[model samples]
Target: MKVVSCLHAAVMVSDLDRSIEFYTGTLGLAQVDRDLNYPGAWYQIGDFQIHLIENANYQASDGIDLTVSTRNPHIALGIQDLEQAQQRLLAANCVVKMSNSGRAALFTQDPDGNAIELTLVDPERESTKKFDII
Candidate 1:
């Protein structure tokens, strides 16, 4: 089978409402679509859509399908402005990591402690490729 594109990504959350607040309020993700079928919310974060669904019914004890490194299968968000994104994350009480090149990246945990990495996109590289700004 050929992999055409990623339709969306799912990250189970303990609290649906708080997850919605974090994704929509703190991160500034737009509510592109939603469904009442389950305890979850869908958000548009740039090019890709993220889904935060309730995990209370999950049978697994891990709660989430993630590793201790928090590196595998991470949702790395690209921002238009690194400084501004860093400032926003800092305002939200997130820990920011500044690079030697002045670029900043922030690591934040969801209500479920899922690691999320947000970074600033390099303008030069973006101009050379098909980069999604939305």
Candidate 2:
């Protein structure tokens, strides 16, 4: 029922290769190999992953406005209990969205509309889970 740790932060980019180069060459983040089925790249930032997805339909922000909050990006967190977290968010009048793939995930937003993804960790496979494949 609690957020264990931040798993990843995903950002939409106009060009996947350029973003990956910047993150890997400039930021010095290790580029983590991922499945080719998806058009994206992953980098290892400490113990967490930074996912960069190419968005062809993304519109550039007019300007950086500190007052606007809904435009903020999302952060995904690892959760201890998916069901409990869902219940807690629902009790607080938060809109929870389930993953279409039936994965243990709950998507919600903060009061300001900033996205948050809560993912359930499989206890048995947590330590040995492989991300390169999927």
Candidate 3:
């Protein structure tokens, strides 16, 4: 019916190996095993995950300090109903983009082009922390 919790945050990284080391070493987040046929790594932090998608061409957002602005890099929120969420976003004239991966999720922007994802996921049963292979 409403946003239940933050599922994860998708961040674009330049180097997979380097970023992975930083996240698992410096940040001390357990790396979760993920094979999405894409260049990315997932890490576990309590009930939430940090998804890092490797992009050699990745560049930080303009002057706006995205860390506080919450733009470009996005957070995915767990929702009860996909259709209901989509309807609400659409009603507010928000642009919605369905997940191309066929998952029960949709993407939208927060007026500032910062991507927000609404996904149907149960965080309680979804933590990959226990399944950490690396």
Pairwise TM-score winner, candidates 1 and 2: 1
Model 1: per-residue lDDT, tens digit, 6-116? 768888887778778878878888887674787788887545688887987543234433323233345777777766876777788754454323335555566666667
Q: Among these predicted structures, which one has the highest TM-score?
A: 1
**Candidate 3 Cα misplacement greater than 4 A, ranges:** 62-134
Name the weakest run of 10 consecutive residues (lDDT summed) in model 3.
125-134
* Cα RMSD for candidates in order: 4.9, 13.2, 14.0
Clashing pairs in 1: 46-134
Question: Which is better, 2 or 3, measured by lDDT?
Answer: 3
Arrange candidates, best lDDT first.
1, 3, 2
Comparing candidate 1 with candidate 2, which one achieves the higher lDDT? 1
What TM-score does each of the candidates earn? 0.71, 0.46, 0.48
lDDT of 3 by residue, 30-123 (tens): 8989979989989876678888888888764554333332334566665656788777767667677777666787777543344666678655
Ten-residue stretch with the least lDDT total in model 2: 63-72
Q: Which lDDT values do the candidates have, in the order given?
A: 0.66, 0.62, 0.65
Error of 3 at 57 (Å): 1.1
